[model samples]
Target chain A: MTGQVRTVDGRVAGRRGQATRQKLLECLSEMLSSSPYRDVKVIDVARMAGTSPATFYQYFPDVEGAVLELAEEMAKEGATLTDLVAGRTWTGKPAWAAAEDLVDGFLSFWRKNDAILRVVDLGAAEGDKRFYKIRMKILNAVTNSLTDSIKELQSKGRVDKTVSPAAIAGSLVAMLAAVAAHQKGFQSWGVKQAELKPNLALLVHLGVTGKKPTK
Target chain B: MTGQVRTVDGRVAGRRGQATRQKLLECLSEMLSSSPYRDVKVIDVARMAGTSPATFYQYFPDVEGAVLELAEEMAKEGATLTDLVAGRTWTGKPAWAAAEDLVDGFLSFWRKNDAILRVVDLGAAEGDKRFYKIRMKILNAVTNSLTDSIKELQSKGRVDKTVSPAAIAGSLVAMLAAVAAHQKGFQSWGVKQAELKPNLALLVHLGVTGKKPTK
Candidate 1:
């Protein structure tokens, strides 16, 4: 559906086209942050953006299309961080330290996009066909990042050989969704990482390095 | 929206109908097990037990009401198992051994009602308000069950103290959702729980007992 949206004004083509779409995307994202996906409509998004419904249709076939596009963009942005974690020179960092940094980078991204991420997290399990596709894309991006890292560690004999990297990767991926559900738990309780992050790091570290967590 | 479903007796009610409505609830439960909640419309449900839409309205206001009624029933049935877990007798079984029996009993129920569970999971998340209420009920049921077991272990000094029992309960609840998501992933791979449940149980054991599973 997003594919059908042609940026209006062929000259709304390059930088201008991108800027216009970005503005529209930005508006829809802002609205989603405060509301559930089903509650918000394309017309509502357009009105919130101070644009015409027709203008919204110019860049998005519907609300889900716009949301999926934004999700894909965020997923890509998330990918760059994964790349950073993967590409980092691991020479000075201990294996555990590297894993900690990767998760921290991931958490910070979630923090920055709290609203959009909240909506996506809430909507991902829904039966919506398009929403599921965008979600799986993001999940793959995260898993692929971890899979490559684990495979590298395995090749170097730095991690366990018995567990499949994909299984470990799946666990690492599952842990994020697990923790993210409680992101709101953070705001409500004001708990610090000294208590939470370390325990979580232990779980992921065990999954990755295949060592028993430090007691 | 569920507060208005007319029953199959073709009688909309106000006809000394309380007993007749009770019969309809029993019929609705039987029908839902064999059909998806989303697919079970008022008319078909009414026809199934020799009733009419008018009589259906006497009990449930609508479809959500029928689903809500059934979900509530399932949770209550599940609580019967919870009562055993919370008992002092322990059935003289090892903890995981007892847990396995409990899990098998619960899962057997799920296996037969896969269609309804799938519908409820999807409908509750998809934008159906009643569905969300049902989902919340299920979460509460799991939390209560775990709370009883955790408190029992804590009193015996079998559970970790550093982690809040609340976190322990929540962590377990979430791993189940992750289990469901993993099962969903398998569907794409042309697989099912036959290939996933044992691994899922291993992960659950890891999460709940804070013991790294050797399996």
Candidate 2:
């Protein structure tokens, strides 16, 4: 569990302080959704939160620091993505359903946190270690579980012996993330959301089971 | 074919002007690699190219405009990616080779143009039409070819009838791109580049053919 939430100046934040910090984060998140990440300023975020810039600085060093906090929170929520794959059977109709549920959950998660995730993605791609670690945290949850599923299938001779479980799982997870991030692009390309989900689920089933789903 | 080179002001660029413009672009590309995209300034690019900011403006309206030019050039090169999937068989052992070649070619191309491609990816994710079009142009080269290949297989009864060719092809291409962009992330996660390619190719083959590769 996270320790006491502390201000940038190292003061332990109480209930009211935490509420204020959360409000600032919520306002910052809104700003990220409406404006380019480069153009988001601390002053604007403070104004939007009905607080002073000094209050913003007390809670965080700068805009990037606040964004990192938001990313960290999202990554924690992303950890629960493991439930979408872990303990799920990858056989017959159930396998197909599992794939569908996983795709649905992953896509929705990305869509909900897209603005912050986009910034995290850019920072990670730009070789920032802090952002990279957070990205890994979010992705590794689903990826590790999927890797286990693939390895289990391979052990039963249902999947190929030569397949690298981690690689396949990682690639599939990345695919899900990429497609989720560009859902609008897919729509513009004429693939509707309803059609996209099934196709994605089918591919996930195919990738994991190495066969077409029994559905 | 592209029309004659011209400046932001609409004047045709002479040989010397073209050289200067190319140099400025090259410097801008270098700046993008070494610094955050948000921090890349026209002044810095001009200084690095040994030109004035006014000169930079004469050629490019702003950093983003110059980046679009870089992305445009990269997209042109990316069109050649079609050759990786076009006319390639999707059956038996050759199918495995086809998949491997596609993975190798795609990964290398992404690595070569990662700095600018990262910016394009971010831009497209943020709903920018120009960047989205460039991204579509690059991915569509392979996705469309792969779609045709899958449809051919479906017609021959090799691939599943229920599969959506465009959806599968687009997802697979997106997987390749996401994997390529985060190659370092995979490395840090303990997946070797040598091991990663074969696994990616396997998924590509499986998604396209609905069966594990013969290899």
Candidate 3:
């Protein structure tokens, strides 16, 4: 009830209004690259968007609210693990193979959108309460998919009977988070996508198989 | 040259003056529990500390600088992964044991000073350049130790050989992060320590050993 809603009269606003809003958010995200969330002002944001200060308030309760909105938007997407490994017949594939595909999918998302991904990292860094749920929800989805695949593999008795798929599922996500964290930190350091692929394949294989990769 | 450090003395002038400065920074971290970072102000900080706004500027240039100073102070100690897992030798302690100890250390720091941790998260959440580097440095230390252990195990053939230790290492930190994120998000939701431990342990064993518990 307290947050701002972009919709009006039960209809999503038009491009002109949306364009103003979009430009404002974009500038805000860029500003955030160097500035902290607490220090930004509505006038500063409006000026950055080249719009009237009143326009800034029209779309957002305030600049912080606008940034929160952008962060939420960023949270809504990324490459899912299942999308990496299987299409229609996931159960048919080896768990390690499926995991590799998932890692690649995740890395690809990081490669393309390091800035937005950094937002998730920062939100969860230590005691950041703001974006914790949104970030966790994303993690849960990844782990849940891994669980499904592992359960399928366990049913086939293809996986190590001593291991639980759910554990592997959660672990796999944690490992990927490290990779994403590394990518965000080193993006300005000229990280080549090729360099990270081997690491991803290696980790994914190890994560699912409970053994180090021979390849 | 452009920052608050004027290059003259680069220090507080007197003892009472220094105490006031420390109190202001310290209070912000705790006060942030009910207040969002953006909602806090110099007046609130000064009032809470029983000081004047004029006196606050004598130390910090502004509120953001004050928070950053605290984050820098915490990170100045600079812990490594080896420091965490060392001095307690085990051939291979179950994932839960190591995880519990590690989480205990992290949460101990967090619970004692939620404000600074909260600020660190906010700074990082905003993904400002400085915040990401600070986060990566701390996590990298944690991951490096786990990675080294995994590699040692690989050489001894005690663990899987095909998997990259780096992957396992990455997963370890990421999962811990997830639990920490959980703890942080539910601070007001009344989530307790008991609910968090199993999750942290589950992540460690699953991610590292890739095995379900024998216990």
Largest DockQ belongs to which candidate? 2
Compared with the true structure, all predictions reach lDDT values of: 0.58, 0.92, 0.61
lDDT tens digits, residue span B44-159, model 3:
98989998888777777777777777777666554643466654332445545776677677556556545565566556545565766666666677767776666776787766
Give the docking tier of candidate 3: acceptable
Q: For residues A153-188, what per-residue lDDT tens digits would candidate 3 score against the true structure? A: 667776666455655555457557656645544444
Tens digits of per-residue lDDT for model 1, B40-115: 5788878876889876776678876666666766655655545434542222335455445444544555554444
Ranking by TM-score: 2, 3, 1
Determine which window of 10 residues in candidate 2 chain A has minimal summed lDDT: A186-195
Against the native chain B, each candidate's TM-score is 0.62, 0.98, 0.77
Q: For candidate 1, what is the DockQ?
A: 0.17
Per-residue lDDT for A121 in model 3?
55
Chain A TM value for model 1:
0.76
Better of 1 and 3 by lDDT: 3
Model 3 alpha-carbon drift over 4 Å, by segment: A1-15, A75-82, A85-93, A117-133, A151-171, A186-215, B1-12, B76-83, B88-90, B93-96, B107-114, B121-141, B159-167, B184-215
DockQ of 2: 0.79
lDDT tens digits, residues A84-142, model 1?
Answer: 35664333335556656666766667667765654465344434555566556666676
